[model samples]
Target: MGSSARLRQFVHDNGPLILDGGLATELEAQGAKLQGDPLWSARLLHTNPQAIRDAHSRFLLSGADIIATVTYQASIPGFIRHLDVSAERARELLMSGVHLAKETVTRFDSGHQRPLVAGSVGPYGAFLRDGSEYTGAYAAEMSVEELKVWHRPQIDCLAAAGADLIAFETIPSIKEAEAVVELLREFPDTTAWLSFSCKDGKCISDGSLFTEAVQVARRSTQLLAVGVNCCPPDVVEPLLDSAASLQSPDMSWVVYPNSGEDWNPERGWKTSEKLSATIPELSHTWLKQGAALIGGCCRIGPALIAQLRRELKGDCTPAASAEPS
Candidate 1:
């Protein structure tokens, strides 16, 4: 079976799925910067593919069953930031991510365990933090025509890249989400999983809750699944609480939350706690609360993932203990 088929089976049998952590932080740590161009966040794609690959390997070692490709900020205008990463170049980056993610498993999986490679399509913004700003402020109306022109190359690339499934993450508004969802409608052979990001109140910048977001994504072609990302873990419980009872006849509930609270852009974020422990605790709670899939957003990394693997291997401390008390 192809990798995506295998992962599809994995999701079906496990019911609950697990994905990897952020890539930009790891890349930045390895020497990525916002040179002059400010659009394409994956500026290091051609010049620093190894850095991206290294980040994926780290997540795999941390026990991630799936790792997303590094095309999050690879839009055309976004690509023009560093060098001229044309739309075709953007396509190459997406495919390259799949190749590297798959290779990581082959290279490091000592026994027979290997993770799935998922292609990640971030919002219309930069990364997660500045991601929200990408919506509303950009051209009025999101412009489906513009999106079709902008996203076609990337979509074709992902479909041809053998990604397990396209993960559309950190979307702040419904229009932006719908535009991509519309693209998925054209590609019946490929499946997509859309995850949105919200403000403090659990409402999307477009003012929809997880319910509305899920509904929109569901209509966008039986999307493999739908959920939230880049929001706080504290909000995860509440959002799950709000959506848990609402049965989706078609879609699965996936939640990829941030390690801690949202960072304040004004003074910047400073967490008093250690991520080594906090992030796993947060994910543990998410898993117990019926989240069909779980992962981390900004700042969370391999160490947190390792903690989760340790906890999962040991029975996850009993569902009762994992409950947010």
Candidate 2:
């Protein structure tokens, strides 16, 4: 079967596939200083790639079926502007994100089912590094074609570098989703999943309805799944209900919400103690709501992923815990 078909079949045979959580979160917990880094976790592709590989391995050992790469902030233009790297070098760094993930998966693939490597193509606001990703305000001046232009090189590098698929994650607008769907035609064989960053139960970060966003994603033949991420877990079931009306049967709903933390560009994550719950306890509710690809986001670590695996699969094997640095 094709990779996309295999993913769907995996969800059908087993329960929902478990996606790995928070690449930057895990990396920061492992002593990587991401604060004020222009490229965020993508900076490790240059200074400490082994750390990136180790992050991927921790998720694998924790029973993640898919590991998203450290390319969330690895756009070529952003690299050129921030790091003063040549376009060629920027492309190499983007490709390195996939290679590190694939290499990590290979190293950790014992006798178990191998995990898929997903190249994370984060929203354009991530490159801005001004918290616009959560509000979609940075993209207000951009057109869909302009968005496509900005995303092309990163998507191009990831696709050429042999990621199992691309993850257009944390998108906050329908225009961005339209651009991603249109960009998919550039690489006919590469499958992708479009996940939005919602602001509330009914709307995306841009205040547009998620139903409209899902409707835009549904236009893509290369899309394997569509849903929300990096949002509050409390809002996922309602968003899923809205997305359900627009998605086809073959398309799965991928949900990996944050630990109810609010991000401040200057101060970083501020957790909500009242909303804090173990991901395992929350995964059951997410699964009940028909989330086919479940996981965590910001402030969620390997221990939570291991707990989810144990709860869902009955495997209590411990993995490397990513303690806060």
Best by TM-score: 2
TM, every model: 0.82, 0.94
Question: Candidate 2, after superposition: displacement of residue 76 in Å?
Answer: 0.7
Q: Clashes per prediction? A: 3, 0
Q: What are the clashing pairs of model 1?
A: 37-81, 39-78, 40-78
User: Across residues 33-139, which tens digit of lDDT does each residue of candidate 1 receive?
Assistant: 73333533366566667777678767766667778887877665555444565766655665776777666666664342356677877665553244354243452
- Against the unseen true structure, what C-alpha lDDT does each candidate score? 0.64, 0.84
